[model samples]
Target: MEFKWSVPLIILVLVNCDLYSTIGGSTLKNCYLCNTYEPSEPESRSYSSESSELVGILVLKIVHLTLNPNQPSQATAAKIRSCCGGPVSDHFQSDQFEKMFSNRSSLEVEDHEIENKGFLDYQSFITASAFYQPYGFGTTYINQDFFGTKEVAAFLAHVATKISCGNKVVTREQLSRDLCYNKEMNSDLSYCDEHYKNTYPCAPGVAYYDRGALPIYWNYNYGEAGKDLKVDLLNHPEYIEQNATLAFQVAIWRWMTPIKEHQPSAHEVFIGTWTPTKSDNLAKRVSGFGATMNVLYGDLICGHGDNESMKNIISHYLYYLDLMGIDREEAGPHEVLSCAKQVAFNPSISSSP
Candidate 1:
């Protein structure tokens, strides 16, 4: 017969989930009573539902599945908790990419004119951007469409700041906060570690100054990234500066990999998978955009009170959010957006890998 829920309660439940999760497509496999739906199960896909009411939901799922059989049901259902808004297919496109790095051509001119120099052409850039999917970069914590977008933007903000040849703080307020390059200009340091020379020997004449999107500086970092990406970066650290895709890959790889075995990756920190320990709380490290800076930059960006460099990175993130048409308000409170008071998770230099 009929469900017992009141109209207002039903409305609340319906609005809470993505429309597709309710009376939309075949996102309702559990309601597939007459079919074999076992094989469609995603081993990694966990359910996000914890509804107090079930009767109305079941009816809605059945009605929706019966109505639309080919609406990418299983995929949508699996990502129920994704970044919440925007079309996933339209999340990060080439046009939007150009907007993020409009000065790519000029930046390249300042550096050197090479073919398809680092993120200038959208076609190659998009193709190479897929390296993060398998590493659990965008889909790890929450699966909102905007999650990927925001991650991309925040990451690119760091890249843009590091690679930028123009003024650091433009008149535009948002441009004021981009994360800078790991490489300090005019530094003669080779970043070669004698300790890892046996395991990851530095290539002769191949000085491992900071390179890549986020700029992996140390010989150890180059060796580790090379092993993970199947690229011999210790010897060929220039590959990052030469190829746009590889540069993005190195950065995304760093974001995905943790600083230490027990530490959380920048991705985890940004996506809320990282729960702060008592030490972390004492250090004021909580999950959000702010923790990402701590994860990536450590003492370089965090711990110092109201540091301009840290604020610059935060501004870049907010600018990118605005460019993506997302409200900067979603980034949470000031502490979560700035790690000024938090203790560094791992110091920039560590004895361990």
Candidate 2:
């Protein structure tokens, strides 16, 4: 399918509302999907701009996965950096954070002792780069074979549509429109927005803003990761487990760390306008499926034995989570393993122990 990659169709239906009306709720300001106006009580609700932006980055990574999954390892973060840039600090050169926090010779790292310190620091810096690079107006290239599967390409197209619309309100459209488009260079040429100067680059034409008209089909493709994630399922099931535990640890760390409170809320920074209240919902829903998929995929890749009983049980639990409307990306590895063992193993959680 060929996407036009043009301006999106945004439907903002606004009806007048009186603040004092109790019998009738205030006139609906924006379509729920379009998000044209403020909710009646904005304070009670929180939004996550960073999440939406991250979604875009994820989409890009998915595309790279289709082109060459291996390239996405660091390319995903690099694209984000190209589009956004990096943080600035008088005490440190924030752009070179990867090297800064890297485990290298003769380096005295300040935050080295933290749990999964390497991953968290890397993620934090990469995320920062994603937030800043979009405004850079230069072509962000990934390794030539960055895409891994067709599913990944389709995902990027889906996210492109989503970002074009106002689903999460990260707004890449405005940047695209305002910037001077140089196709050969794949760069935007525009002065940064004064208000966003300290952090985000303001590439007016090149930036994206409205994420409303994103098709429902994008959500439909959430299963690709599961389908493709089979390689890890069979062979390196442990990795799936590790990925889940790590994600859980990251979530826990975010909750416990004082730094999270000090940093701008995801919504405050980028586009997703609602607070992420359902992370646990995601954690719970994806636990079983991710592990199962990883094991299955691994088996597929490694030419292993077929276990019908294990498959049936894993499918049953995965179907249960599907009914709840959680996506595969949200599925963690540990949950997947536990669910697999529940069905795959009769007495013990492990095959032998």
Candidate 3:
């Protein structure tokens, strides 16, 4: 997407020159001199006109920096430097966000019997992203060039699939009906694991079925996410449903963090930062979108030979890539996008100890 400074934003900078001078520091060095200078008592009376002219010149300089993409203001550069992939606003704007989830937010969709209907919105997702952008939640650059658009699409694909309530179809329109549900429906299971009782005990009344954008299940999962986010989800797992920002934040945290020690995170696998070991290769796992599924869901939705669940996820990803103006072909061949034959990174327990 082309980056253009809006007139309102430019006018805001001009009006708040003092704020800019404080934050921009060396970048707006002369701005402070032009705006803050004062002469002795006798000369101060005569300095008004000259100071006003100097301030006008400073405004012109600031306007030039704002309008010229080649020369970003210091404040803008600082904001961009905070993210590994750069600011998401630069690549994914509000219009694209609306297009992606417009169906989910429609009145007809909201009328359906779904838990937390109409709960997921663009603002919540974008606001939550600010926290993890520094850790490359969406911003992942390969070189001087930005390569995070695909990565963002891949991550959102997972989110959309997990939370979607659309029909089980592989078409683009069907896949765009995402953000349908924030929490799992009609689930009575507590999903509490006894293994982590000592480390992460389940609360008496709370049931950790599935909640949040990616739907974190099990007591241990909630415990870990709560601890990291400092939200106390073990006691109040329902918090994920009540807060949209927290829901998306938990999802992004899961995407960026490794499930176990000495393991690759979903982010690492998808962005090609992870190298497959001898075991990973033997298990048919490679660093790509496929390995990301292996890293996150393991054998649950993988190693099942073209299963419906896995296919649905891949469809969402490819559809999102197209919607974001990224070619689906860039997602690679079927092998790089499928985890059908891959072994689970963390297999489910078949036999009790």
Instruction: Return the clash pairs for model 3, or none.
Output: 85-139, 85-140
TM-score of 2: 0.16
Locate the minimum summed-lDDT window of 10 residues in model 1: 23-32
lDDT of 2 by residue, 14-88 (tens): 001111111112211111111011112111112243232222223222221122213223435444321211121
Q: Supply every candidate's count of residue pairs whose N, Cα or C atoms clash at under 3 angstroms.
A: 11, 77, 2
Which predicted model would earn the best lDDT?
3
Give the winner by TM-score: 3
Give the Cα lDDT of each candidate. Answer: 0.59, 0.23, 0.68
- Candidate 2 total steric clashes: 77
Q: How many backbone clashes does candidate 3 have?
A: 2
The Cα error of candidate 1 at residue 166, in Å, is 4.6
Q: What is the lDDT of residue 37 in candidate 3?
A: 20
Tens digit per residue, CA lDDT, model 1, 264-309: 8787788776778888889889998888888887887788888778
User: Per-prediction TM-score, please?
Assistant: 0.68, 0.16, 0.74
Instruction: Rank candidates by lDDT, best first.
Output: 3, 1, 2
